[model samples]
Target: MPHDEAQARDTYACRLARSLHNQVSTLLGNRLAHLPGRTTPPKSVHTTQLKMALAETVFRKVYKLGLVPKIIAKLPVLSLMLAVISVCWLLILPMDGQFRHTYISENALMPGQVNLYFRETEWNHVRGFRDEAAKWDFESASRSNPQLEGWLSDFGLKVSHHHDPQTNLSTMYALMHAPRGDNTEAMVLVAPYFTSDGQKNVGAMALAPALARYFARMSIWSKNIIVVFPQNGHTALRRWVDAYHTTLDVTAGSLEAAIVMEYPSEIDNFSFMEIVYEGLNGQLPNLDLLNVATTIARHENMQVSVQGTAPQNLHKNDYWTRLEVLARGILKLAVTGVNGKLHGCEAFSGWQIQALTIKAVGTGGPDITQFGRIVDSSFRSVNNLLEKFHQSFFFYLLLSPTHFVSIGTYLPSAAVIALLFVVSSIYAIARGVSAADFVASIGSVLALFFGIEAICLVGAISLQHIAISGTESSGAFYVITAALMLFTVLSSVGIFAVKAPRFSRPTSFLLLAFALYFIAMLIVTLLIVHFALAFCIGISAFPLTLVQDLITKTHGNTLVSMKARVKVVLCLIASSPVTMIVLLGYILDGGKTEGVLGLVQGLLSSWHEMQSWTWFVVALGWLPAWISVVVVCAFGDFTSLEKEKTE
Candidate 1:
């Protein structure tokens, strides 16, 4: 009975399986019959065909909905809007609650915890030294200064001088070994012989030695103190720093921090202290170091300023004041990064050493002794550190001395501006790809792109060589002239290249797209290391988005209208590298010809001496991009080229 029942169940299961198989086969056959070919596909090809059909259905639905192509078409307009929005976003960053209040992230940096003791005795010594230093010729007193070296030695320091054979400049430095700690780390006190503006730094020369004397009297220091008197300019100091890290005869220890004193004015008092913190290529010292100085100054009831913000306005902290301060900070950072003008402390950069300058502002306020106390307390706080400054913000935008916006808060603004170029690039690429001769157009465009870049690269190398060989005045002229000549050559190439019979409208579009994409990538990479520079360049180049290959069909014969000509002129005025440099020189240097020349010379010196990439980036990336835009605009209507061919 059981065997009969089992046989019945097995027969029912087999019947059900066959019924399901027949149903699936019938459905598949009907689906396949409706396919476009209407032929039985091999078993291996059947699944692929089904997947392709599904994808085609989805793509068709998406296309009918008009989403992607519509967005791509409007990308240029959207990009312009985004550029404006980016500026607005930056302005909004200074408002309350948008930025963070400055705080000491490292507990070891107890800035004002120590007692203040720098006083009248030290002030007397500083006065004496200042009077003596004022008598010496700072410019001619390079290789030997017996008076200054004698004073440093009197202060119980190991004094030595380093002379660079190439530049014929000299740097005299004195080291005070720490009595309480090991000689594995040291701090720097730099008193440049001349201010960044080429004025004598008499007060700083006196103050540095007097402070070293005071530091010698105290046994609380954990890091050895090195007093440096770099003659000629910041370059001398940079050379000294390089030698210290590499080949200096006298060794102290690894440099961990530096404080540059710039008391250019002869007066014993000042309005306020200006903290100069921008470093080479937009690098910054640890925020804790800046906060330490600020905190110590405030603790002593002295006014503090950053980025040249007036002391009176710093207390207001209103919307406009904050915005102005923010603008000044950004502009200063951009200028410092590009021009390589040293503000006394930027020389310590690129060596993993944190540094800044405290410059005495105006000629009336806190006595010089108070500034001494600020330095004294600051060094004392630094003495308390167990390790290097690692726990504070290194990348930040200062809204005020007491408030800041870090990278996470402010990077998006620059990123948004950079995105405009990317959007325009994408739109151009899409248009170019849809053309019938895409392969030929892309190949030619790439060749043109690389050709222009090659010219720029050669120009950059030539500029560097000129900078190295030429003097300050003549070097500036040579650099400017060389750059203009290169641009003219590039513009001529672009104009003539587009007029060739083989170069089509698609080629122009592709070339412009390639240039825009390169610029966007450059800005993106710069944002990581130099946010202010990236933002400045991105905003200045925003006009590139307006560039397009204007094509209009009129009757049978083709001609460029007045609008295209106007666009070319406008783009040259707004986006040309020459125009931008001239405007920046006028605005920042008060339109003085010498000031502009000095700026150019400074840029060259920075490139040659410190290996700053600003000149290279401008020469190679920015100039080429601008030339490509001009070329595309010069292309005009494609029908004109076709008519010429027929003729």
Candidate 2:
């Protein structure tokens, strides 16, 4: 038992260890293979080996998480937190005087620095135009337009008429070329002759032509001044602007800025002036333009209002009153779905020209002379600009005429709302769903999405056509029909939810969520591009994304319980596009000083034009999201369905 025997024993022990290690390795590998999503182990494996293999397999499976799902699971709360913070940011926009007071950003726009020279001569001309124009209403406006055109031509300026055959309306304008510059850039002064109510902006129309004549005499001008006497409302201005840019054979050059004057009364005195900057579909003028207008108004000792309400005083009670005024301004910009003539300034914004409306509001003794001086001074500031109004903020929310919130301060709310959908869609995708399944599910839903879009488009077209072709009496019925159709289309998603199989339901939910997320992204992109359109769409549609993931955690259950179903139903109802329309209609209508029926009539008018993106965004963007939520809620309980199928 000496050295030779010891060597033999050591060698035998080494060999035994090697053999055991190989056998254990093989068993573990075979067990792992037999686990779910792996190849099955051979039948020849013994119980001891199988047990060892099973233990190793369990260990591996427990720790082998896919990177995406693991990351998503860790970050589910982020979206919620962002959403909460975003909503809170909105509240903070007004709390404790958080909004910053506005000042001019462009050095060239030296607001309120110029002394206004519009005086008795201008007033006399305005009076003459007002008195001469007092006989004209909407019906007679077209007939009298030639006379106005001739009068504008008498100022030795180039005059033109823009007529839209569809509405049988005419817009008359006169251009006075700049004596100093090449006339490559121009500024427009729009004076709507008729109000949306078919009355005349008597004072403004008179004032613009007089200003044009006065401006034509000034040899110091560096940009052409175009005086627009709009025959209709925003519609005619849109037409004229379109003609100047694309349709008409005229060289009006790039529009630098615009001023819209609406003085509907013959009193020649207004207590306050409302600065209407919110444009068509939420377009806004440059902050510089607003600042210029406000500065001039203030200099003239004129009380200024943003969206038509001026805080009477800064007293403690009036602080909340100011807040209400601010909220109204924000909401008006947020809900720019309607077409009113006073918003002609908004149409100019779409063409990249900064514009705003100076409407003389309230009755008696602010003096049209003061209003004219405000316009004169504001125009002088724009005339000083060497380039476009790009130096100042193109996106802002006016709290008062003097206070505002820029994009950086107020954008987080919309961004957070859009981002929630983004995070949720990513979370859904990360939930172990196969890429092919995701792709196939998305493809299926795309078909459904486009089909739904087609149906909606046809319905919209039919309603629009019916409204146009029918008499005034039938307009209400057609509008009601359109509203009902929209509701039905949105609510119909519940039908598919109740019918979709449990197996594919989660994937379907993911697809729909992704579609919704994409829509949100589009809205965000649009917000970046055009804040008003995007903001309105985002706010209206954002609530639909707030619903709990209806199909997400229902792994064992296919159908939700009756209680859960009720909650889902209620949520769907609350966030439905139809409901949003009604709520928005109420809010807008309330602001209109019109009752509920008035809102209905406005909605009908909006629907009839089919030009307003307000209804379409609701029907298309918000409707699909609503439908997706309903479908997810209606999904059968996959766990129970699978069990039933297997049985």
Candidate 3:
């Protein structure tokens, strides 16, 4: 080998070895600098720094992507998941070790700490009241119960009579002024002359006056007690409350709290009592009032129940029963917002005065005398309250007298369901459908909805046109049925009239979807603001969501297909006012004959009289969503829709 070639090869090899050493050193330095707990920077740390910066940038972009509309579109499923979780949470409320026993939130409410003095003497007075009440007819007794007035006056309290010429009803209230404080705030004890079901209030009407006399003698009262005797249950109470708050003819103060007692003549004794805390529009009294009432009743050894059922002590053995009771209570709470006569306390709720009703059902155990002691104890507890009720939960559901689910726990269920609709609506709007097309589509649906509702309302108002000279019950049933049939026929005709062209099909479907979402938003707002109402309507109206898909598959250009017709029938049957009536009748009347027909008749009458807008809201608010879905199904074309989208 040549000397010069050997020298060049050795030089190249040495240079390559030095370069490899430098590269290894750089890698090692970077690795060491990136090690945990190493504070010092390496000379060649740019690679690691560049990798970290890239990772951070990726993370930032990913976070930003989450806020986009496509991500927002996924919220409906998320809301559904949340709703399911919330419902599960509700069921857990009745589980073992899941809920805390209710306690007095107001330290001043020293409930059950005072001794009650009512005895056999109070019983004698109750008997006298019942005898006196039996002497008069409903009309005369309702107009002027002089015996009651005389008996109340004998107690040395100021008694006054209120007559509403417009209603042809009367109310009487006796005031027992406070000895310890001024008459700036007062508590009311309401005794309706007639039960909500039109039965005479034998026990409460008699006992309330005697109790008023008893309370008038007590010197420890800081707030004046007003004993009220309204001619009837709901309407009379509203009139009296309105007169009390508005008219200066009767001097009265702001109402702190109120208790309504309905002891029917048919029931001599009740084994247990249900505490009805839910009032009109789903308004709840301060949790403290319910706690105090239950505590006092239990102190008297009375079995306490909620929503017409006694709490079972099965200890994790009766999970489903408790859940059923809890569900029933929620349903009742939901319906309370419809301004039914289910609870007389609903009247006071409009005035922001906390109120509750204690309805004694099925006669068997606690007679008037024993019940008087419970009442006495409750009043004593209320007397102990130093300030207005403000400390306890204003939103809650009583699974039993002891266990409850608060707003924080149960609100998420309805909220999530409501949000699901909202997400569906936003997605509807995002489908490139024009606002004009959406509005026109909705207008057609609204026209049908409003037209049906108007017809129903007009028929209800002009029931006299049905000249069926038969029995009142049969006549009402026939007339209402005929009216309902007419409405269905008219609504069906209107649905057929709103037939959209192929181009308008997608727009109509999206419009209906958005309207549903808007309704869901309203429902969510209702759930947040008025939970019972929202839950009641939201749960029942859930079937409306299925109509769109059902119709889309069953119809094309016309609802002539049997499948489409069946879907339409199902939608109407499931979401109609009749369904609401049946559900309400089942809950309120246990599905008795008089209950179902009576509920329907009352709803019609109330709607006519403008006393309740619940039926209107149901017919108008829900029908639009329902009809729009039907319209989409009858007229939409999926193939054309997809083609347009691609173009």
Candidate 4:
């Protein structure tokens, strides 16, 4: 109705009001500013200010990686990540690898040389020594072998001797200290016995004197040699070695290889001798160096046996041969158990010591001095080492005389089980999970751990008492039983009492671990004689979560608290994947191991002789797929739900 100017002014005012409304809405959530409907663009910063701000922002984010709530608090992504990690074991890997690694770099080897006539010629010296040793009437060598040290001292060795007659049941020890003021990088142990009257003794005590005489007279070795005359096997030998190690300046590297001669009647060092590399698990020595020695031995016409490869398989690289070795080596030797001293002490050399024994049972080969030179040469070869095999694989299994599968190739064995950890954690954080459910779930995990312990102990006992009675039959059984019972009782009581007192906590844990071992022994003992394997199976099946949770939670950590929840989810999901396999195992009723053990078995079955590349494929391929299933199933919609809640 007004003039045209009035109409224009009115329209302009309306626009101004709307602008003010937007500004207010943005500035004060739509209540304070007049420009409520407006969205103001941010003011530009100067170049200097912008750069400074960006740098500061980056620093802040990085600094908070360990401290911020979001790092551990980001549940959805973490849950998904964990889930994928748990299920990857279902994938398959190539089981057949060309027995040996063709990829091992060979530039550093001194591979082909033979002919140690010096060793073969030592037979005459050995015979005179053995016959004299047989004539002496023997007592516990521990009580009477001091003169042997004087004889060794004359041969240019610093002899430090020990005799623990009462404690060791008369076993003697003569430690030949590595000679100083020389490049003493090797040692040879002569196990010939002392001559005595038609001696009646336990495990042949007089044999040591003969060994002393045989080695002291040998002149074929260029390396420093320890011509030892121990009272008996392992016990006396370990003590002598221990004493020698202590007296010598251990900070300096000395003493290269050790050779123990067990043959009593042999008068000669024959052609090349057979090499026995004993034990499978942690006790096994480095193989590259070993292979090199074997090559040399064969070149010298000496045979190599893993352990008395009876009626020997000359073509040892066959699949079954390799599989049996890998399976038993990984599962049996890797397991923690009481062991014989020879294999046990061999572990000290970081898996490098080899034992060469020449027996008179149809095998005509290398004798004492021939064996000595080989020991000397082998050590000299090892001394040539510039490093501790850091670049090569640390864990591996030999499938054949020439074949090997590395730890990288075998990781699925562990990864499959490790995934279960993540699965269990995811389950704990699932929407409906509560403390009660957590405990119940955790209990099952505990049950599995206990069950596995029970099984392993029982299996070991059965293997001892039933399958094959080992060297120390009665003592091993009794020791094992006592150990299990003690371990269990301590673990239960200690773990349950996490809050007894600050100082007492560690005490409790120690007591508990011991108790767990004892409890294991008792359960194994009470188990029906025939059900030993079941006991072993049950113990292996048990989850480590109970112990993990106890330790992790007792420490009281935000990171661990979150991880605890994650462990629950993983344990839960582990059930589904584990279910079918368990049902199948029960149905089959044979060699039924569970949890980490099943995955271990699965991996062994699939990749007994897998190559390096095959291992890589299995780890990546299997780990991701299984982990993916865990993510989708357990972590479903968590991110979206969070975003919706935030919105």
Candidate 5:
């Protein structure tokens, strides 16, 4: 009986299997069947369909295994790893095989190829002029200097003067026509009456005329030479440059390059030549021009320093030293770009002029003769250029006077940092869109962000007008008061909005996402014109990204944990632009109150005089982003108030 039952079951199973297989075969045949007179499907089509089926099965299996979701979950970690890798890549650039050895890209710049004639004879003239300049009453000197004008006139050059009504300062410039060539291109020799430190620049004053006299005699020149003695400070230089471009009494050919000589000490000796090449708005002279100057200085047996790094340390190429130099270069570049402080060379920016400052550093290493030789050779190299500075890089970071990293290599550093912001923004946006109240959240976020940004924009415009219209003291006072008022108002609004009963998680996430997106865009925009500034701001503000996760975890909590509170404090401090500025001022000036005040004043002055965007960026871009983060993290997520109200 058992054997009969098993046989019956087996027969039934076989029959069922056969029935299913026949049905599947019939379905396939019907699906593949074409209309009357249609051609049969190709074997390749069947093969392709089979492959697609296999791929779909595999994909289903993978998806079921949750690999894709896992990867998506790990995206932030992956992004962090990439950001770290990018930073490591940037840090390693000072190592050998990382940065390129700087070369003269412009073949016309045959630096140090010509024999230098600036010797003891010129040194004697320099000393004599130094004594004569030292005797002048520089305190009352303005609008004109008969001694300087007479000296230039004696050199058989066209002398002219420009007075700026705003600063009540004067600029005296003399043009020396190239004896052999048409007055189509000119080089400048700037010897500001005062050094960057506000001391009497007797040595530069002396050197300018000596070089002018020496250049006057040389018939091998092609471009005309202009010796400028800009009085007051960098503002004076800017006035002169502006007038030279627009409304000068005497004009030469288009200006091509300028060399600012800064030898404040009456003594003729110096340890090294510190090259100041960073310009206004992060502008840089052509790389070839810097290369030419450094090469000539080195050839003349004069040590060369850049961005205040010691010349001796540069030769060692010690990893720490290189790193320090790299860091300093970036910091200085950022400061210069943001502040537009007059470093002599910065005055020549925005006019297609390649300019650098050669300041005599230390004392008793090389005499004035060697310095003069460097200047002379540099001018000769510039004189050889047939056109404007176009061959070499306009953007580069000097690891040392000899080595540098070009824009192509270093730009990725800032780009990667900016990418970090983008990733954070995308993550925030993804989470924001998934919230239950997405549409309402987006509307609120847009209104909140735009409203705050509009206020900031108005405030920035007002500060700019104040900076431009008011006197320095009154302008600074009003700016400070207005800034404080704006800060108070914005902080109150952010705090009040975030603490409101209707504020929700979606609103917080959307706000953060919007702020991050704004920052990312700002950094990317700045990267093109001011790489160091962009990188600095990017890294400094990266802590804001952490606030998003913190807010997510802490939102609606009755009591925030100590760890979360500490994190909130840290984020606030780290991402605060005001804190960064104050810290920078402290680092730069030893925590002096005056230093911070002076920095603020300098920003105002830069904006008023040169139309620099530093203040605008700080007021509109950075401060707004920071405030948004602060609002979301510090006040947006604590739902205890809502709980209390419900009770």
Candidate 6:
């Protein structure tokens, strides 16, 4: 067979007969052009080159797909970190307790370790001084007390006074120098108008402020003390903190703890006064400090508050019995929009500020001097040279005085959310969806994101409508629904258009992310109409973009399905009956701090729960929905490659 074929091909050589060969070759070329052959094909090119090119293209697509995973991985790390930081920030960060966290730039300003002997140095006069000081209100007391400045200046202090018109806030500030001879180091000091029922301690408004100014000098500490009355409210206080801190180094470092006095509302005095400490997100004090303060204040057994959870009348070891006011009074106010922090307003203004509200108690005990001495002592103790408070627990849960859960102890709550993202990411990468499918997914994400934004906005506007109509808004947020529908339509059309291929997908997504983040921050900033309401709103609105990228990308077809919609609605409905309704009703009640706290805690938990439920639907139900969508859109280049092959 081979011999016969060879003989025939040799006989039909193009070189042998040119004209005859040309006619046959032309016909052969025309017919064979559609066949995969090498006679007239691009033979000079390396198959390796073609292989490499195809491989490169495949790799590029793979690489592009990997970009999403790389970005997605960050979702877990950042989200977990943020939630963790928030928790840590709540603790050791300081609050209205036996002492607040005050910043000491220098290591030397020992506050109360001297032979000033304030204990035996006139315990009786605190009441008289306090009563006399109470005679004048904030304005009168401030006007009458110019010497307060001169006194700090006498201690070799450079002083500044801030007069805030908004919220009618005023403050007096001074920084003490290191001792002239020993010259330990520099520090700051501040004391502003203490206005409560137009009265001070007993006899201190006019004279005690002047003399109280002297206590900083007598401290014999190393660091300078910047005592300030950052008032006019939280805003003014926050402004002052910004100005003050700006005057210092502009870098990330530990801010020394701060102390703020709130004797404004002290009329007489009850038993041991309550020390209200609310760390950022239910953070508590350092265990060492807690123990020390408890042992020293004699009310070590007094109540404590972290976040809004304070155990009522908590007793530990039978000896150290501190009252844990379960019903958060002042701390609750700060958490639920009632900023009871005299100087706490400054913390939000970019000053890592915390405070301690130590007021005198016990019928008629611990006058201004004693209270001042206690503060001075605590500050002096802090002044003792030491590294940052990194050794103790930064994140912990308070069960009692001695028991606590460390950061290592309680990371599970945040970890659970992060884990879901991890699983979703792995699946998206392995599926190897095509570019068109990718665009479809992204379009869906865009719809979802804009849809969410529209819903939230409309609800906000409608709420405003009701607020103006009477004071409260009713019914579901209709505007949000309309916005969602409109955006969904827009997104769907945009993805389906002939122009979709023109724009660089990555660039578009990047630009969109930037625009959204900016818009979010702007909306948050604009809520300053009512500081309290603004704070509440700002928090509620600020963190949506936190893990949004992860959440949106995880949405396959299951999320947008009719069945999924039913589940989502059922979730919404079930949420109301079980917990959301109760919370919604409570919040609707208005101005109820306790109710609000309870509601918020529940709502937060509920929101988290809903996210988990959504994740479940996404992972389990999304496949079915995605398959259905792909089947329906098979001709549109949106089906899975395997499905296309099978068809």
The global C-alpha lDDT for each of the candidates, from Candidate 1 onward, is 0.76, 0.65, 0.66, 0.38, 0.75, 0.38
Total residue pair clashes for candidate 1: 0
- What order do you get sorting by lDDT, best first? 1, 5, 3, 2, 4, 6
Can you give the TM-score per candidate against the true fold?
A: 0.86, 0.78, 0.77, 0.49, 0.86, 0.49
Q: How well does candidate 2 score on lDDT at residue 470? A: 57
Model 6, span 1-70: residue lDDT tens? 1243223322322122333334544654554465575665554344534654565565455444444334
Please provide, for model 2 over 421-510, each residue's C-alpha lDDT reduced to its tens digit, 9 standing for 90 to 100: 787776555442445667667666667667666776776666555545553564565466466646655564354345546537545556
**Residue 137, candidate 3: alpha-carbon lDDT:** 81
TM-score of model 4 (CA atoms): 0.49
Model 4 per-residue lDDT tens digits across residues 1-647: 12442333233334434444444335443232444455752343234345555655554444333222233234335434543442232112224633345233433545544344444344454454445444554454345655555555555455544545423533333433333324445444545342111213211222333444444454443444445555444344444454455653332235444555444333443332334443322344455555665666555566555433433654455555655555434333322121221322232232244433332222355545544444445544544454443434434555544567655454443443333334334322332223354454444434534454455445433433331333324454345433533443343233323333332222222222322233334324322321212222222333332332323242345786456545544443342223323343333334443233332232222222111121222223222222232222222221111111110
Off by over 4 Å in 1: 1-58, 65-69, 337-340, 435-438, 475-502, 549-560, 635-647
Model 6: lDDT to the true structure: 0.38
**How well does candidate 5 match the true structure in TM-score terms?**
0.86
Clashes of each: 0, 6, 2, 113, 0, 69
Q: In model 6, what lDDT does residue 39 have?
A: 65
Ranking by TM-score: 1, 5, 2, 3, 4, 6
- lDDT of candidate model 2 versus the reference: 0.65
Runs with alpha carbons beyond 4 Å of true place in candidate 6: 1-116, 139-159, 164-169, 180-219, 247-255, 264-269, 276-292, 298-312, 316-355, 359-370, 386-390, 421-436, 443-567, 570-647
Please report, as a residue range, the 10-residue window in candidate 4 with the lowest summed lDDT: 638-647
Report the C-alpha displacement of residue 598, candidate 4, in angstroms.
26
Instruction: State the lDDT of candidate 1 residue by residue for 300-379, as single tens digits.
Output: 78888887786668678788887887898887777674453577677787988999999888877888989888788888
